[model samples]
Target: MAELPDWLRSIPPWAFVLGFVVLPALGFPISLFYLTVGAVFTDPALALAVALACMTANMAISFAVARLLSGPIHGLLHRRGYPLPQLTASTEWRTIVLLRASPLPWLMQSWLLALGGARFLPYMLVGAPVQSLVGAGMVLVGESLFQGNAVWLMMGVTAFLLGQAALTAVRRRLRRRGSAY
Candidate 1:
């Protein structure tokens, strides 16, 4: 909750994008970046957008790295007679969303989903929107808290609730689709 350095405030926009990608991709905690984006960006919506884009890139890159390693790990484990977890096609989206929204640390959630057997491209496509919706709420809340304003706090709450509702609807629809197929 301490003041951010004046230098941080002066950071270029692309640095934010790169920071979000590199920090999270390397397994550094990302909530702080989201929180910093929340505190720094004057526009809550814009902050969310930046955070979401960075987070999406982080997820894709980190997941890709893990996924690339997984093949070898899978082979080794299989040779040793271990069973890897598998994600059914229908439940994949639901699982991804739930894990992304869960209270687990960001890196943990990403790694779990990466290993859950969802197709890479599909997970990337579906995961980005869900991450953005939830991440935007977090940024809004962070913005409100940093600014110490009651009105902003209310807006943050509203944004968070709306995002959750949208995510729930998405999850339900995914389930229904899963069942139908």
Candidate 2:
């Protein structure tokens, strides 16, 4: 809730971009980056592009961290009588979509999927776009608020609702099919 530091406001744009790519791994709130992008960038499309790229990079980093720690975490969990779920190929993308669409924080989703043995290709392919949609919505909403543009606000709201609706539809289908997430 605090305002960004004065220095942060003055940094070169490239530094902001670099921060976007690196800060989330250190527990910085990515939503801050998302919300701030609109105010910073002159072009909405460029803002959205940068936000998506940053989000994807953050996801990749989280996944790599999860991969590095997976063996130790898996062993620890097993010793404690808990085991991470193994995602089968058939259900992998579906799972990724669901988690990406769910309310879980972006970092958590990446970590969960990577820890669960999600393949890198599928994880990036399926998760990035879906998650990017969410980030795009945030960027839109941020831009709208910063610019006081009602149209962009509505678009952002619609994007968010559509994501939720898709998640709901997928869950219903899975339920009917007698499959559980």
TM-score of each: 0.78, 0.89
Question: Which residue pairs of candidate 2 clash?
Answer: none
Tell me how many residue pairs clash in candidate 2: 0
lDDT of 2 by residue, 1-181 (tens): 2244334447677888888888876677788888788666748899898899888888888888889999999999999999988999989999999998887776677778999989999999998878877888888898787777898899888888887887788889988998876
Please give me the total number of clashing residue pairs in predicted model 1. Answer: 0
Question: Model 1, 136: alpha-carbon shift in Å?
Answer: 0.7
Candidate 1 lDDT, 52-145, residue by residue in tens: 8788889888898878888887888889998577899867877777777677887777777887687887678877776676676667667777
Q: Which ten residues in a row have the lowest lDDT in candidate 1?
A: 1-10
Error of 2 at 71 (Å): 1.3
Q: Which runs of model 1 end up more than 4 angstroms from their true locations?
A: 5-7, 75-82, 166-181
